[model samples]
Target: MGRQWRDGRGKLVVRGESGDVTLPLEIASSLRARRRGLLGRDFVEGALLLSPANSVHTFGMRIPIDVAYLDRRLRVISVRTMKPGRLGLPRLRARHVLEAEAGAMEGWRVRSGALVEVDTDGGSDAHDRPDSAGTPSLPS
Candidate 1:
């Protein structure tokens, strides 16, 4: 029901009624990588994905960000634009979190119930963290 991805670069594809939107993706699966996500950087190339995460904070960030909480199925649970110096509420159903520049998600058709696909450099890893979920990972 959850995904186990390694630290790498890839693409995040969001399919919507309009069309497919692809964006550069950075996978943050390690504790260190996920902890340093988008911090201290002026901006991001596209998006950063934090696996096994349910919430995020922007206490020291320089820029605003668009955050999408995804459930175990990669379906968006909710989307929010967070300003600097804010702590996001944890979504009980979220198993992964996607962060992008402020206002970027709106144009990408990222919203509640939207299904997403992560294409890692070596292909998507299918596994589940016992503490995170109990079913298969990303859709094949």
Candidate 2:
């Protein structure tokens, strides 16, 4: 398997019409980390990035979250807010998934066709090869 995410630690800068929005990045490139997700988190300061993920579920989560589906070029495909115990559909074109606190996407201007740029801070990249071995299927 390729290098796993540096424990989902980094930073991201989303270019907005008014200004750039920066947030803490939590990358999930490993099967284990991807499976764990934000299950027990009550609040998220920034966002969680799941590389090679097409869908997500908030089965055991404590708080609602905003989901952003991005294509290979980091362009947003769609943005939706999912409450706890919800499942998101898989986007065929999505190469990565970004999750944040509820209503965070609107504040950051994350929407369809918007380009998201990842600002690397010495951690695994969104394009890094995701670990496939024993990777469980994500909810759709």
Candidate 3:
């Protein structure tokens, strides 16, 4: 659930639910979040932005993280672990990127087809109402 960037032959250790993986950094660079609303947060731990067919490098992180590779259309193509201070090789068709706490994806059931919904409005819908028993109703 953390990230580590690499400079050379560094080791990345990701502690998973059942086990762990220590791998080398394929590509290394400074990772920053570009989403609209994440600016004020103290720090972004597990997040990524993939370019179209480019490389990702990690050289200055302290923890391990999970990386999700997305295609140009923002569809997840693959996922893997990147240890601290390593590099991720270029994926020819990669477009978007997502990083998360190690093993969090599996814990949250996040998969290729799972949709990521960004709420830009920052407001709740008026139609969101409670049912007869005071239970919230689902969106139509």
Give a tens-digit lDDT track for model 2, residues 1-140: 22223554777777677887777888887888888888898888788888878899999989999999987667789999999999899999887899999998898888897867665555434453222342222222
Per-residue accuracy of model 3 over 1-38 as CA lDDT, tens digit each: 11222222222233345554433322223343322212
Higher-ranked by lDDT: 1 or 2: 1
Q: Can you tell me which runs of candidate 2 are displaced by over 4 Å?
A: 1-6, 122-140
TM-score, per-candidate, Cα-based: 0.86, 0.80, 0.48
Candidates arranged by lDDT, highest first = 1, 2, 3
Better of 1 and 3 by lDDT: 1
For this target, which candidate reaches the highest lDDT against the unseen true structure? 1
Clashing pairs in model 2, backbone N/Cα/C closer than 3 A: 8-27
- lDDT (Cα, tens digit) per residue for candidate 1, span 1-140: 34588988988889798888888999999999999998887788889999989999998899999999998778899999999999999999999999999989998899998978787754544432122354544444
Show the lowest summed lDDT stretch of 10 residues, model 3.
Answer: 1-10
The whole-model C-alpha lDDT of candidate 2 against the native structure comes to 0.77
